[model samples]
Target: MLGRGSMLVSSLFPLGVSGRRAGVLALLVWALVACRRAPEVSSDEVGEESSPAVLTIDAMDNEQHVLRGGFSVEAGVFRVELYEGSVLLGEALLEEGRWSIPWQPGVGSEFLEVVAYAMAGTEIRTRLDFQRLSFTEPEGLYAAEALLALPTEPDITTRYTLDGTAPGPSSPVYTTPLVLLNKRGQPAPLSLIPTNPDTSPETWRWKPPATPPVLATVVRLQRFSGETPVGPAEARTYLIGQGATSLPVLSLVTDAEHFFGHDQGIYVPGRMHDPSPEGTAGWGTGNYMQDGKEWERPVHVEWFEETGAPVFAQNAGVRIHGSGSAALPQKSLRLYAKEDYGPESFQADFFPGHPLRDFKRLLVRTSGQDQQNSKLKDCVLQGLLRETRLALQACRPTVVFLNGEYWGLHEVRERYDEYSLASHHGLNRKKVVILEGDGLLDTGEAEDAIPYAELLAYVREHDLSVPEHFAHVEARIDVEDFIDYHVAQLYFGNEDWPENNIKFWRHRGGSATPGAGDGRWRWLMYDLDAAFARGAEANSLGRLLRDERMAEPFVVLFRGLMTSPGFRERFVARFHWHLDNTFAPERVLARLDATVELLAPEMPQHIARWRYPESEASWRDEVQRLRDTLARRPEVMRRLLQEELGSP
Candidate 1:
C-alpha cells in the first residue's frame, strides 16, 4: 500500500513498486519532478486525465518558416523554449495556455525548433518540434505579364499586394503563381515634338514615355494547421520592371554585410561636421553593372550622393580616374580609377570611340543650383561657355541605379585634373600645373605655389592700368579666357567665386594657342550649385566686383584689370556679346523648359524617395522659382552692368 503523496508520484511516472524501496524511489521522483513545476498548486478540479496537456503549432505547415508567430498548448504550459537548429533562441512564459515569440533567426538559417513545457501534477512535461524557414527576398528585373512562382510548403498560404502596400491577412491569398502587369495600364504611345525651332522635321525622333513601368510588390506568408495560425508572418518586397530604357542603367550590387554592417562602409558618416582630413577611409568593394553587363572586378565604392536618400543603394566609384556634386542633399560626387585599387579604365561606350571613353577620373554633379537658378544653370552655362570657345568641362545627364534601385538623375562631368587637361588639350599629364581656388597646387613637380603667388603679387604691387603691367598680366594668363570666365560667372551671379570654387590649369610647355603646350592659366567651371539665386541675386556679381571689402587675390586681380581701359573695354564687349547671344532669354528659357519636361516624369519618384518638398505642389513652386529667376535675372544683370560699368 502507498500514502497519498506516494500514490501521486506513482501516478505521475506509472512506476509499479512495493515496500521500503518503493517509498524511497517515490520520494526521489517526487522531489525531482517538484523542482521543475511551479511552486503554486495548479487547479485539478477538471482532472489531469480529462484535460491532458497538448502542444501544437497552428501556422507552421510551410517549408520556409518565418521567424515570428504564435504557439499554443492545452491550458497548462508554463514555459516554452525556442531554438534555431542546435542554438537556443529564447524562452517565453505562457499566459492562458498560449505564448507568442518573436523568432529572430540568423541570416541564411533554414530551420527552427520549439519546445513547450507543461506541468501535470508534480511532473514537468515537454513537446519538441521543428520547422524549416527562409527570409531571403526575390531579386532581378521582371517583365510585364511575367508569372512569378513564390516558394512554398504544404499548408502554407501567401498573401501579397501589388500597390506597394503592406500585405496582411485580408490581402489577396496566393493560390498560384502571380502574373505581373502594368496595373495602371500600358503607357500611352510617344509623340514626337520638335524641341528646337531650327530643327528640321526629319530630325525629330520618337520620345519614350518619361516614366518607365515599375512595379514593387510586398508579400506576407503564414503557415496554418486547419483554422489556427502558426509562427510569425514573414514579409519581403519584390521589385520588377517592364522593359529597359534607351538610357543606360548603372547597377551596383553588394552583400548586405558590407553595405549595412558597421565599420568601413560609406553609410557611416564619421566626423561629418569637419572637413580637415583630406580623405575619410571607409571604402567597400562591390561589382558594377552598366548597360546589362557586369564587371566582375572588385571596385572600391562609397556612399557619395547625399541629402536625397539615406544609405543610397547606388554608390560612386572611379575607373582609372580620381574623385571629385549639388543641392544641399543633391550634392556632387567624385570617382577615381586608381591603378592600385582596381581597373584603371572605364572602357564603356559612354561616348563610344571618344576620348571620354577612357577617362581616368570622373565627376558626378547634381544640379541643385539649377533648381535655385533656372533648372538649367550648369548645363546652360557650360554650353554657353563652350559655344563662346571657352575651355569648360563636358557634362551629360543620366539616370543612376544603386544595387538595382533607381537613384534619381545625375550628370556625368569631366573631372578637372592633370588627366583632364591632358585629354582635352593633348598635353602630357606630367607637364600640367593645376591651381585650386584656395591657392593649393593640385598637380605638379613643385609643391610650392610659386607661379600663381608671383602672378598675384605682381598684380597687387604694379599698376595694371599701365600698358606695360597689363601686357605682363596678359602673358601669364589667357586674356580672352579670363574675360569670358568672369563674364559667365558675373552674368550668372555666382556668389561662391573669387575666394572659392576656382580652378585654373596651364600646360608647362605649350604657348597660349589652343591645345598648344604653351602655359597660360585657363579657368575651369566648378560648383555651380551655388550659382543663380541660391547664393546671389541677379546683380550680386556686379555688387561684389565693386565692393572693396572683398579682398581675395582673384578679386584684387579683377580690380586691377578693371583699372586698365583696354581690359575694361574688352570685358564690357564680351559681356554684351554673351548677354545677347549665349544668355539670351529666348534661348535660355527654351533650354530650361526642355530640362523641366525631361525631368517632369522622374521628379515624382525622386522627390518621393528623398522627401525633399512637403508636397508635389511645393516642388512645382520651387521649379517655378527657378523660371521666375531666369525671366527676371537677365534684365537685372543688364541693369546692374549698365549702372556699374556704363553701357557698352
Candidate 2:
C-alpha cells in the first residue's frame, strides 16, 4: 500500500512523464514520499464543535515542490504558519473553511512544514513536498526533431502550447511526448543515414536546405487532475539554429517562478501587469544560462530576450540600465563582468577580437522610446553618427529570450564608462576624467573640473569675438568634436541635449603621444532616443542657439563660439557639409531603409511578444513617421540655421 505522499506522487504520472526517463520518476516519487509525511496528532489533541480536525495539507499544484502558488488545506483552522526548517516562510488566514497563501520556496527547500492552529487552540504540523522538475532532453542546438518529456505523475493531465503563449487548462493536452520539428515537418537527418546504400543501383546524395532552419518554439506545461488544475504551468523554449549570423540570437533561461513571481521577479514591481505607481520599483536579479549551466544570482538583471543560437554567454552581474526607460515595464539592462561576482569578463566573444573584448560592461537597450513604433530611431541616429567619425558606442540588433520566453528585439550596445575609455583610447581608467553637463565629474578627481569650470567662466566673462579670448577657449576644448556633436544633436532634433544627456571625457594630464593627453574635452555621443520627431514642430536648433535661458555650460560655449567670425564660418560650413552629405534625404533615408530591412522580419515577433503594436501595419506606420522626419528634418534645420545664424 502507498503512503499518502506516495499516492500524491502517483497522481502526477498522468501529467505526462510516463513513457520517458524512468530514473527521474523514481527519484521524484521517493522525494515526494519522503518529504510529505502526515501531520503529528497529539493524544490530547481533539476538535471542539466549533473547530474541525486538520485533515490534510497539499500543494495546489502537484507538478513541482517549489511552491509559488496557493495551497489547499482540509482543515477548519483559523491560521497557518509555513516554515523551512526553523525559519518561518509565511502565514495565512483562513476564511470560511479555505485558506490561500502565496509562497516562494528557497533553493534546496526539500520539505516545508505547515503548522496549523484550529479555532479550538489545537495545533497540528504537516510537511509539504517539493521536487525540481527536470527537462529529460537537454535544451540546446538541435539538428533533428527534439523530444520533450517530464517525469510521470499519475492521474494528472499536462496541457501545453507552442505559440509563445502561456499554457492554461484550455491549452492542448499532452498525451504523447512532444516532438519539435523543423519547418519541413520532417525529422532532422541523422548522421548514420547512408548516402549510398550497398544495394542501391545508383549513387545517392543528400542536399540540405539552402537556409539553415530557425525554430523558436516556446513550450509551456500545466498539470491537471480530471477537471481541476493541479499545479502552476512550467514553460521552456527550444531554439535550434545552425550558427550565429549577422543578427545573433541570445537564449536566456532561468527558473520560471523567479522570473515571473509576484514579489521577487523583475516584472513584479511596476512593469509587466501591475498598473500601480508603486510597482515601478521592479528591478530584481536572476541566473543567466549559458553553455548548458545556471550562472546563479545577485547579478542584477532585467529580462527581455527569448530565441536563437547563443554566441555569447556569461555569468556576469547585470542591472536595470536606463534612466528614462527604466520606469517602463520593458526596461533596458546592463551586464557587468567583475571579480566580485565570480567572473572577470562576460566569457563569450561578443565582439570577437575587437577592442570591445577587454570591456566588462554591456547594454541591452529596448529602444523603449520608440518601442511602440519604428524601433529604429536610435539605431539610425547612431549609424549616422558613426559615419561622421564621431566617437560613439557600437550597436547590434539581437533577439532576446528571458528564461526561454520570447522577450522581443533588443540592441546590444557598448556602455560608455571608464572601461570604454580604456578599451577605445588605450587610457588608464584611474587617470581618465569624464564630465557630463556643466562640468560635473563622473570619474577622476573632482578638482579636475576646475579647468573646465574656468573655461566656462571665461566664456561668460570675456568677449569670445576677440580672437585672443576665442583662441584661449579653443585651447581648452576639442573644437571639431564639439561641432560634430552639436550638429548631430540639432539635426536629429534631440530635445534632451546641452542640458541633458551630454557627456565629455578627457585625460587628466598631457600625454607623450601627439593629441593623446591634450587635456582637451571631447564629447561622446550617447542616448539619442528623443530624436526624429514625426510631426511638424518648431525646430530646437534655432531656439537652442539663440535662447539665453538655456544656460547650460555647453550651450554657453556654443553661443560664445558663434560670436566669433572665424568660429561662425567654420560652424556654418560644417553644418552645411553634413546637411548636403550625412543628413541629406537620400543618404538618411537609405540608412533608415537598410536598418528597417534588417529589423522588419523580426519586428512582428517582437511586437507579438511585447504587444508594442496592434499589428505590423501599426509598426510600419511608426516607421513611416521616422521616414517623414528624416526626409523633412534637413530642410527644417537649414531654414532654422539661416534664420538664426544668417544664410550660409
Candidate 3:
C-alpha cells in the first residue's frame, strides 16, 4: 500500500492480517505486499434484480462526469464482480478474492451493469454495493450546496458535522444549525437538538471514540438526521453550553450514504479573491487557520452551512458528524502535495487519476499554540494538517505550492504575517493553499529546518499552518542537493509508488531556496537532483554505479560535461569504486536490471543521433520523440540492461 509519498489503500493491512497475501521471493528484492480484503456483500446491499449482488444505482439514476473510477472492496472477502453489461472499468484484479473496478464511464444514462464476482475456494459470484449518481449543475451555480440536495432514498440519511466521526441516530447532540469546523478547519453551519432535552436530556450525552481522531477533540461535534428535538433550541443550547466544558475529544458521525458520500464540511462561494485563467486561485484574507495558532487579534468566526469551523473549547469535544453504514475510510477524504522536485526529469511521477480525491470532507489545519494542547499543535504543524487537506482535495489538481529557498529566517516571518492576513479574509481551505515549510524541504539540515521550526512555532503561537509563500520566497536559494532530488523524483516519477531504493528521502526536512517554486523546471532537475543525492551514500545510486537507464542518457551527458578524457576515466573509476567499495559488483550488476530496459531502445536513438550528418537526430523533436517512444515501450528497458551488461 505504501508509495513514494504515502501508502496505497491495499497496503494498509499487515501481511499476517490474513494468511492469504503471504509469500516471499528468494532474490529478496521484493515488490510490495498489497492488502486486499474481499467483502461478502449481500445482493440486497447492491439492489440486484435477482441475485444477491445487484445494481444499486443505474445509469439513469446516477450521473457521473467520468465513467471510470477505482473502488475498494471490504478487506479480505474477495468479492467477485459479475458483469452482465457495460464495462466496470480498468484492470480488475482479484487479490484475496475481492473484485475492484477502476472507474470507467459509458454514456450519461446507459445500461451499465455490474455484479460482485470474486474467487473463493473455486467459487465465483457477482457482488456490488452502492451505486453512483450523475449530477449536472445548472448555469452560474457557484456553490456546492446549490447542486447537492438531501438524498431522497429514505434508507439514505445525510447530516453535516465536521468533526471526523461516523453517523448514527441521536448524533445531533447540538442545537439545529450546528457550527463546527469542517475539514478545511472552516466553520460549517450545521447543528441539531433534541426536541425535549430538559426531559430527555440524557440522550444528548453522546461521546467520541478514542484513537487517531479524525479531527481536534475540542473542535469535535456530532450530528445526524432524525426527528427534530421537541424542546426549545435555547434549552439544548444551555445543555450544550454546560457540556462543552467537560466533553471528551469530539468525533462527528454523519449519514454519508444519503449524500452521494459528499462533503460533510463547509463550502463557500465568492470567498475567493484571486482567480486566474490557469485555474489557479490566489487566497487572500479570511482564509481559515488550523487552530489556536491563529492571529492574536481574535478573528471573527462565521459558519456557512456547506462548510465552517468547529467551536474550540479545551476539554470539550469539537463536533461529530457520523456517516451511516456506508461510511468509507476517513483517509479517502484528505489531501497532500507531491509538488516541487529537482529537474532530473521534466515529467511528474505520481499515481494517475489523482491520489487525494473524492473527498467528502475538508477541514482546516489548526493554526497556532492555542491548539487545545501542545501535542495537537505538533501534529498539526508537522504533517497531519497538510496531509489531511491534500487527501480531501483529490482531483486533477494544479496548485501553487510555496517552493524555492528558506528566504532566510526573517523573511519567513514576513511571509507568515501575510498568511495571517489571508486567514482573516474568510477564504475556504480548498482554494489558495500553502504547502508548509517542512513539506517543501527534504533534508534535516539546519538551514532548511530552522525556518520551518519558526513557521511551526508561529502557527502554534498564532494557530495557522500556512506560511507566506510569497514572503518566504525571500529566504533565497538554499536548496539542499538531497532536497532537490526528492523534489525531482516526485516531479519525474509520474506515480508516487513506494520506492525501494536504499536512500529514500522524505520532504519533512528543512528550509530551501525560496524562489525555487514549482514553476521553475530547470531548478527541479539540477538543483533538486543534487539535493536528493546530498544524503545518499553507500549503495545508493551515484555517478559510478550507473543503472542502465541512468547510464544510457547519462553517457551522452557525462561525455558532454566531462572537461577532458580524464574526466570520463575518473567518473568510470568512481563508479567501479562504488561497486568495489560497497556492493558485490556481480550482485550489484544483477540487481541493476531495471535500468537496462530504459537504455536499450535509446541506444539506437543515441546511435542515430551520433551518426546524424551533423545534428540531425540530436534535434529536440527527435530526442523528445525517442523519449516518448521509450516511455511507451518501457519493456524495451529490459533489452537496454541485457544488451549493455551482457549478463544474459
Candidate 4:
C-alpha cells in the first residue's frame, strides 16, 4: 500500500502509503510537485508530438539472450530498453514491426520492466510506452540453501534489510544474490528465581526473555525510482540448515518498533502501563492489553512444514490474543488476512485431509493456562475429542519466531469465529450467531442473543422433568451436541468451565436450510488448559452435580435435564460410549505419548526461553501426571455417575 510518490530518494521503500500535509511545507510542496510534472523535453528538440510509440514484451527466453517483443508505430524509429532495478538488462532498436533485445534475465529474477523512447534528429523525442513482466517460483520450506535475486533498471535501485524491518533509503543496496544460512545455535539458559521450586505455577508471572536472536533469516526489500518507490515491498523467510522436526514452524517478521516502541508497540509495557503494587500477582494493565484496530500491527507470516518445506508466505495483520495470556512473556497472537494487509484469506491447505483449508484467522498460542505445565495438554486433550459432534479448534503444534527472534514453542490453531463456523458446517458466516457464557453474543448482531436468552429463561422456569418440556428444549438446541460437549469437558475435568469458557452457535436462517440451519444450537470446545489440573481421582462429575458456584443458566439447565429419565438415559449412554472409545486408556495414552514425542526435541529451547516448567524434569512429571489422570478418570467418572443417577 505504500505509494510511489512518497518513496525515499536513496532506494526503494515498501508501499502502503499514508502521509499528512504540513501547513508550513504546503506551498513549497505544491511548487516542487508542479515542477516535477513539467515535461523533460521541449517542442523545439522533438519537432512536434504526433503519434505515441507502443512497447510490448512478447517472451523472455531463460537460456538465450533473445528478449522478443513488438512495437506499435511502424513509421517512426524507436529504441527499447529493458531493466531490472537501476541495472540495464538489455537494449535494441525496433526492426520492421517487432524488436529483440540482446539480454538474458538473472537466474532468480522475479520481475522486470521495459520502456520505449522515440528519437528525432539525435534528440530524444518523448518517453512513450512501458510494460512489466513478472514470474512466480515454487515457494515452500527449504533445507539446504536459498538464493534471491531482484531485477535492476537504470533509474530504479533496490534496498533490503535482513532484520525483518521495512527497507528504507539507508538500507543495504541489493548488489548480488542474497544468501541465507542456517545458524540455529543452542538454547539459552533458564531465567528463574529460587522461590517456587516444585513446578512453575501458572499464577507466577515473569518478564520477557532477553534470549539470543532467531536463527532464521527474514529478507525484506523494495525498489525505488529516484525518491519514489516502484511497488510494494516484498519479503521472504529462509530456514537454511535448521533440521527437520515433527511439528510445523511459523516465522513472523515485523519491524522492531512495532513491537517495542514506547508509543505504538503492542508487545511491551508502554506509556499506558499501570502496574500492580509490588509483591502482588496481577497481569497489570499495559499497552499490550489494549485491543481493537489501533493495537493491531502489520506482520509477515511464513509457514513451513515439518520437513522444512514452505507452505505459504504472506503479509497479514496481527494482534495480541487472549485475556490474561496477552500479558505473558510468550504471548499468543491472532493473525488476520484482511484486504488491507494482503489476502482476504490464507489460501493454502494448512491441515492436510481436513475439509477446511483456507483460514480467515489463526492463533499462535503459547499453551494458554498450561504454559507453565505440560504445554501440550490443551492440544492433546482436544485431539482426543476430534470425533465428537461439538465444534473444536484444530490444534497444530509449531515453533515460532518474531522479528527474527526465537519465540519458542507455540501452537498454530484455528480460531473460533463466524468464519470458522461457516467453513466447518457449510453455513453462511453472516447468518451465524455465536454466544459465549450466559447470553453474551460472540458473533452476529446484538439481537442474536435473544434466542439463547429465551432458551435459558424457559429451562430456568419450566420443569424439564416433563417430557414436553424436555422436548421443547431439544427443539431449540442440538441436545446430542450439547451432551457430547459437556461429557468431554467433564471427562477432561476442565475446572475452568460451566461458568467461563462457554461457547455455542446457531445459524440465523434456522430451519430454513439443513444441517447448521436447522435453528438448533451447537456447542464449541475450547480452552481446556485447566483440564486434568487436579489429580486422576478428581471427581468432576460430583462437582458439577452438586457445585453451587457455577453460573445460574448452566446449573439450572444441567440439573433440570437430569430430572427426566429420558434425558438422563441419553446423557449416561453418551458419557459411557465416549469413555469406552474417546477416553479409552490406550487410545488416550498413545495420543499423549505422540504429542510429547513431537514436543520433546524443542522443549529444552522453549523451557530455557520462557523458564516455564523450570526444567525438563518438571515437564516430564506433568506429562506423567496427565497420563495417570487419563488412566484412572474413566473408572472414577463411571462410579461418580452411578452415585448420582444409579446404573446406566
Backbone clashes for every candidate come to 31, 24, 196, 19
Candidate 1 runs further than 4 Å off? 1-240, 243-247, 255-261, 270-331, 340-342, 349-355, 368-376, 511-516, 534-537
> What are the root-mean-square deviations of the candidates from the true structure over C-alphas?
18.7, 21.1, 27.7, 19.7
Model 4 residue runs over 4 Å out of place are 1-147, 179-203, 207-214, 275-281, 512-514
* TM-score of every candidate: 0.57, 0.60, 0.19, 0.75
User: Which residues of candidate 2, in runs, are more than 4 Å off?
Assistant: 1-143, 147-246, 254-267, 270-310, 347-355, 512-516, 534-537, 548-551
RMSD of 2: 21.1
> Ten consecutive residues with minimal summed lDDT in candidate 3?
404-413
Using lDDT as the measure, the top candidate is 4
Cα lDDT, all candidates: 0.52, 0.60, 0.23, 0.72
Better of 1 and 2 by lDDT: 2
lDDT of each residue in 1-648, candidate 3, tens digit only = 212112232354434442223211211112232323335778777865443322222111011222221223322223334342554343334443223343433233233344332221222233332222211111110111111222223333333222323323544332222211112222222211111112211322211211111112111232233553221110000111111211111122222221111222211111221132112222221111111212111111111111111222111111211111001111011111111211111122121343222111222222111111110111211121122111111111110000100000000001111122223333232222232213343323435435434533433343111234322321322323323332223222212111121121222222253322221111111101111122211122233235354423222322232323333344334333323332332333232232233223233322231121112233333334323432332223233323433322
Candidate with maximal TM-score: 4
| lDDT by residue for model 1 (419-488), tens | 8778766778898888886568877867546877888899989999899999999888888988988888
lDDT pick, better of 1 and 3: 1
Candidate 4, 1-648: lDDT as tens digits? 112222221133234321222212332343454467656886677887666555655443322446666665533333456676557665665566667776543455544567654322121222212222121353555544434565567878988787678988777776655534354542322222121212223555564454554466667878987667777777776655556656788988888777777678787666666343211245565667789999999988888888776778888999988876666666788999999878889877677666888999999998886898898888898888888767878888898876555678999889999898888877788998889888798899999999888888888889988999999998887888889988998898888887888888889867655467798888889898899778777788888888877767777777878888898899999999998999999999999999898899888878877778768999999999888888999998899788877865
Query: What is the TM-score (0 to 1) of candidate 3?
Result: 0.19
Weakest lDDT window of 10 consecutive positions for candidate 1: 284-293
